[model samples]
Target: MPNAAEILVDTLIAWNVEVVFGLPGDGINGVMEALRKNQDKISFVQVRHEESAAFMACAYAKWTGRLGVCLATSGPGGTHLLTGLYDAKLDQAPVLAITGMQFHDLIETFTQQDVDLTRVFNDVSVYNVQVSDAAHMENVASLACRTALARKGVAHLSIASDIQEQPADAAKRSKRNRPAHTPQDMFAPHCLAEDAELDKAAAILNDARRVAILAGRGAIGAAAELQDTARLLKAPIVKALLGKAVLPDDHPYTTGGIGILGTLPSQQAMETCDAVLIVGSTFPYIEYYPQPGKARGVQIDCDAQRIGLRFPVEAGLVGDAAETLRALNKRLEQKRDGEFLGTAQNSMQKWREMMHQSEDSSAHPLKPQRVARAFGERLAENTILAADSGQNTELAARHVDLGVGQAFGVSGALASMSCGLSYAIAAGIAFPGRPVAAIVGDGGLAMQLGEFSTAVRYGIPLKLLVIKNNMLNQIAWEQMMFLGNPQFGCELQPIDFAKAAEAMGGKGFSIERADDVERVLDQAFAASGPVIIEALVDAYEPMMPPKMPRDYAKNFRKALPQTPNRDLIEENVARQPAKTMMEAGE
Candidate 1:
């Protein structure tokens, strides 16, 4: 007979969870005991905050393409995982958050440590389940990991503390199948010979003189096809925030990411194009699309459910982008000389000029947005960029180059912070020897800074360029825009991140001036181990790079239709300044 905690650990191992990242507590003593005894079976990485633990797990999964696992205790411990899991959900990072509950009998009984774990975690995870009996633990655990991994999302598994201490017959345990890829649709789209579909899609592109390509994160797998499709259609590509860097910024088809905070080119592309092709993206905002009836749409995707999820479509064809684009390319009569794209290309050139001006090192107190641009210039075309939430994400989205074969990992829907280090680690492991770097904010950095150890332990040595703004800059901006006032708990006291890194078994350096950034970054690359380079970036800065906004007034104000329109919204915003919303006004 083995302890229930042992059974759970064994089940996690069987699920192929290579590493566990989290903190320990009284409720999970049994699990901790078992973890100590069976150290080799599953390695544990301790993090400073439960949020960081969750962040690390999400990163590990993203980098490794496996189920990233985390464990925490009851009450506050369980609650701490909420933010990180939400990031995992939004980013589509495959992470598993395992938490301990009080005695099964104590649930909803006014017990001291009891909290509705599933209810609390439901919003943050695609799936959240609580185990009642030992008989079903293995199946549920395996299912949770499999679902998170295969679906590339977050899943939560909670168990009673007392149940973890219960005895289990180790011999009775059974294993379940966990597969990564489903069966592929073998035949190419052209092979189907669907008569009117290809001809119609081809006709639509050929007829439209002014066309736009709206690409999203889903377009990543179809990068080459999308690029070729752009060439065939002569459509300028306007990417979603999550879609940034998929197409090289310098490409003639690249217009930039579109949204409230995006650039003028993206907005103009969406507004002016006569024909718009929605490829592998389900943009959340419909208003960002060509004004109703302004532009006709042709959507190509493998998932039919996503076709008309956001906007009305004149045509929706269910097919893989890579397969569909290749087929569509064959039928597409090369359009008239890139006249429409040429006009847009001129607009893109203006954009390039604006970026250069904004990124000039002359901006004092170094802007993170500028730093990202500068960093981009020095990074390898092969650099793997991993960005955390807040201004860092926005900056990266707007500035990072999609150099030839560069792959970026952002918490697409999850938008979690502190995911950078783990993601960089995972990126390093997934694509070994490629330069992996992450830009994180102070609040986000503090949330899961401990993940640096995982990078160091695994010998990842990923470069970290911390945008130390000492505040929840994103949220603060939201408050500024929506409430017309800044609020409390948005600022943070600076920490010696470099020293902290040394304490945590990694190298740490500080950058005071903007001029020192590139030099320090170069030095960091030469270092032997994982390094944290904290750049004391300017505070109260905008996350999106310095550029003329399509509608600055709209984005800087509360929502037109009033939702939870705050001034700023990004990943990781727990530690804020003590100033009251009232005090911020004066």
Candidate 2:
């Protein structure tokens, strides 16, 4: 008979798990051995850190809509999985995390790596349990996978080191009766809104002269339906960051992303529209939305509880986004008035023109926006782009124009750093021959630089664009804007990222001059294996909001006098359009 660890691996295979990302440790030796024996059945991806394992799992789930599995040892290893597990939880991705605990007899005796993992994972997991016997392995593993898929969140299982080595059929000899086996089959029911609720939402949408649609990650697979709905309502579609690929940035009806990392057309649409159709997005920026009583609202979401959590809605359609939108489309009448959409599109055109000026600049130290735009222009048809948090996210949100068949994602709710590389790794592994790239800032990449070796080890061809600004640019700007404080403790010593990548057995390219940007990027992307392109971006390039707030302007002015690169900041700020295209008498 197989051991308990073999039983666990078999159960995972039954659920169709193709790969597991993790690192080996003494606590998980049995599981590691079993994985080695079953190498042909289920692949093991060894990451440098346990955190990256969890992150890779989360990204795999997000992109493939399959259950992502990760494993680690007890104590610090289990604790390291928290950030990525929380990212999975907050972003509603299905992930299964397995960790090995101390020996069964050493429990509560404070042995090495003896931390109680189930209790540690309590808040982050939808289902959390510890296996006390070998016979319970299959049942526990099945339940974890089921719960993760059913709830679209994290599920964790902790197995004692000794229990993992026992015989799989140990329960047959014991007096304890075995529980019924859980099936591996999983399916999502097609949920739709009631006819009455659909009618109410349709009426509100049809009655309004100017309608605006805010699409989030929930609207990802419903692009055709969303486009049809937008065309019928003659509405401008504004995307949240996570939903950046729902509609291409160049789509005529789309005004691009909303909020700080968004476009002026989106802000204008939200401010002026008479009705709002919110789909699959719980964007937290309330101030960027229409005033409470100004516009009638209709929201579609899979979770009923999140319906009115962000904004008051006249109708809440609790169902799948595509199904609800398709049902609601039946009730909506085609709007002939093209004024709202026309004006928004015109503003978008002007905004793109203004953005082009920045992206086409000839500054000595390259502008971040220019790098992002060049990268966007070079993306392959099916490339998966992962962006790290901070100024890199802002740059990508503003400059990257995703093409059809491409996908984009960031750490939406958690906003964690060091996720970009892991996300790209997951994408590379999930789709073997597909292109994968990560846009990351110098500060963010420094946190998980070891993962570059992991990419080399696995032979996953990941292209990473590191914006080498040598500073925590976002936090520095926030200090000035929010506290009127001068830049302090934000500067970073420069490191040659290209050289570092070359040392890790991967191709490396560097871009220091404005003229070298396109050539170096082309060379990097054309390379056979993993590549890293380190672009020396201007540190003083300001990451301003689409519409600068009065208080923010005041604070910026107050902090300017003492800022280190005040002259450069002022010059860059002056280059931006003083008013939005709509506000500039367009």
Candidate 3:
């Protein structure tokens, strides 16, 4: 029989979908039944929340280099998927969203939680299709997959309730020989002075006292290639946190990701470098980045328009980072006279030392930095770290040393709050068997802590460390820094997270004093289900040493005529641990 649900599943299988993350509901009963019958072909992962389902798909796609698929019922269930979908879209991950719609007539007329799925998702999605009939289901489904994979973003496809129950064609058909779209031809628009621009960029590099490479998320795919280039040029790699995987933190070329919340090395490198190579990332922290006139910039991007759009570019290349690097590396002459590479390597060591010092968790009120680092030490190589926005991301980014197989998930492009729990759920499900931890703020945890119910319902073993400060500390700190004093609206009447977890059938413990943090976390580690370890830290402890106006002014200073000594980084690392150990009374 040609039922719509069978046809949809056939089409999904044809599209090479191996997994679907979703929660079943009445609206999609037919589809659910069909999927259940064919469980051997496609695995349906039952997630607690639709948002986590979507995020899980996104994580799988990002990690496996495949298109992720997520499904949900109508209205609110469908709507909940948006936040995670937006995260996938912004991060350039391929996620195909399937949602069930109510009966056609009931849609706008308000029939039992009916909502306009297409209209709501259109703005947030790269492409959206709402099928009114079952016959064209295969075409629509294929288009949705193609859109998501081709654009590297989110695509939403909605099927009406009635249509899903209709009989489908016996066999699914596909176009094996589809023509690909023509690549953009921007070269014609900017054919002026190509050779001259290359000459200028090369001259800047040759004459530069110090050079630094800034890799954004776009550069993540080409991290190692970029590192090779950086090593050859003797430049430190300053990545954005979204660009976390580009250069391994252990690499001497990595100076740490740059921003206002940047590590000391990133800021220091940006302050002194004469030549900057900008790749893949449209980092919004322009104030922290080198200004247009301050340094010679060479920008590389997939879209030519992005190159030099933010900062003035002395030269720009429009291509994939890996492709561009291959070409750029060809044109460069290595000064291997041991002048640049040696110095940059020495400076990198010093910067890592200083970071270890700052991450020292020895104090009366525990710094989030030390806690995150200690947690990192206890975690496995393949463990997934789910980080929330604001201070959580900052602390995890600066302090967490990722192992070869480890990956950290954060709301980079969307910068969404409360993404921590959802991220953990998806990452945990996608990576199954690997321990997943959510390092979140008290305020951020409250955002989607309701979903902990979902985690408990599924009996997924996930760890959550809540930095409970009894306030929206990041917001309060920002307000204090930018607007004289902290303003209202930052206060959060604290709740006991541990108790809340117990109420929801998960383990939760409320630990206020610093001494009790690790004990609770250790207990949670041993617990079988989702556990919340709430550490009551200061509202804003270790506030990043409060950057002053003078420090800000140094950004505008000219690139120094000499490269920094790498030995300083080694010294910093050597001194930091001993200092932390003494302070920790270890």
Candidate 4:
């Protein structure tokens, strides 16, 4: 008879989980032993930190659209997984987290490393439970896995140390090694919109002269439908940052990203369009949405609750984005007007010109955009980009164009830093042979620098591009834009990231001049095993939004410090003199 740990391992294998990311400790020794014994069926990725394990699992789920698993020991080990677990939860990725606990007899005894783990995990997990005993192991493991996959959220299970080694009950043995079911077979069916919902959405869409489509990650699976809908309505498609590559950036009707880290054309489309189609994205930034009462809105989302959460929805079509778009496409009449699309295209062309100029800058301290563009140009057709939050998000959103088959991943709703390296590790592990790159800011890299060792130890060929700007550039910009406050505690001591990589047994390269950007990037991309490339980016460059809110300027002037950093301010003004000057009304 198999022990509870063996039953848990068997159950995971039955669910088709091939890899588990985790750290080993006494609390989870039984499960670790089971994992060792079952090496032929599953691979366990050992990470230095429990947090990295969770982050890696989250990234694996994001990239593969499957249930990712992570394990941790009691107390601090379990607590450490919460940040990454929260990232998975907020981003709505499917992940199953398993942690160990003190023996059942130690309940409320205040034993070392013993805490109320179930209560601690309740907030982050969609489903949380403690395995009662050996008899319950199979059911708990199976249910947790299924629930995570079904709900598209985190599911957590904690097992007492002694319980993990107890033999399973004879009656429950049959369920222990059950064969896996396909995700589609095990989860709920993809919901389709009702005809009435489709008709109402079509009517609203058909009445508008200028229609704009805001596509999010939910719209990724419906690329063909999205393109057809854009054509039918003669609309300009604006993508949310998370949905940047839903359709190729070069699509004729596409205007690129919207919101703060978005393109000007996309912002213009949202501001000017008479009607908007919100598909599969609950983008929370209200300032970027069309002015209230100016445009009628129609939203398509699988979850009905998110239909009108961001903006007021005149018609909400609750269903899968692709199916809804396909149905809505048939009911709508093709609009003959091309003025809106033409304006968007012109604006898009201007934006592209600006981006090209930024990329081609011959400045001594390399423009970060140049690195992003050069890397985008050199990527394999199917390369996957894992972008960090902050300045790196802006750079990747504007500069990295996924050619035909490239994919992009980031910590979407949470916008967490330090995820890029772990995400790249997961991507490299999940999809071997495929090219994977992690685009990160220096700040983000500093937070998770230890993972560089993991990349080298595993020999995972992850391309790590760190933009060394020597400041928390995004926060520094926000200090001015949001609070009108001068930057404080945002500067950092420079580190030779290239040397750091070399210290960890990985190849490293440094780029200080514009002339060496392409050559160094090419060499980094071509090299096998883990590679880190640190680019000395222009510290003075401003991470400007397409448009600033009206209140931003008034607040900026109100809170402007008497002793501001003149050099920083001058550099920013020099880059976008018109916008900066106008914002100050100077």
For each of the candidates, the C-alpha root-mean-square deviation to the true structure, in angstroms, is 7.5, 2.0, 8.4, 2.8
Candidate lDDT values, in order:
0.71, 0.89, 0.71, 0.86
Which portions of model 2 show Cα errors greater than 4 Å?
171-176, 577-586
lDDT per residue (tens digit) for residues 455-529 in model 3 = 776666788888887777666545544443423577789888988999999988766655765776677677887
Pairs of residues clashing in candidate 4: none
Clashes (backbone N, CA, C under 3 Å), per candidate, total: 17, 0, 16, 0
User: In model 1, what lDDT does residue 502 have?
Assistant: 92
Q: Which TM-score value belongs to model 4?
A: 0.95
Q: Write the per-residue lDDT of candidate 1 for residues 1-586, one digit (tens) a residue.
A: 6666786787677766667878899878878887887789787766666876776677666555577888899989989877767777766778888888888888899888788889988777877888765655645666776677655678888888877777655324345422222222222223232547777877887888888999886677788888888888788999887677668877778888787446667777887788888887877778778876767778886656677777777677777677777777787777777887887889878766655655664556675656777667767767788888787777776666677777677666656666666567657655556788887778877866667776777777477888887878787666545455534567798888999889989898888777787788778777877788888876745443223233433444333234232322321111111111112222
Q: Pick the candidate with the highest lDDT.
A: 2
TM-score of 2: 0.97
- What's the CA error at residue 145 for candidate 3, in Å? 0.3
Q: Highest TM-score among the candidates is held by which one? A: 2
lDDT: worst 10-residue window of model 3: 555-564
Candidate 4 Cα errors over 4 Å, as ranges:
170-185, 556-564, 576-586
TM for every model, in the order presented, reads 0.80, 0.97, 0.82, 0.95
Model 3 TM-score on a 0 to 1 scale: 0.82
Candidate 3 residue 242 C-alpha distance from true site, Å: 1.0
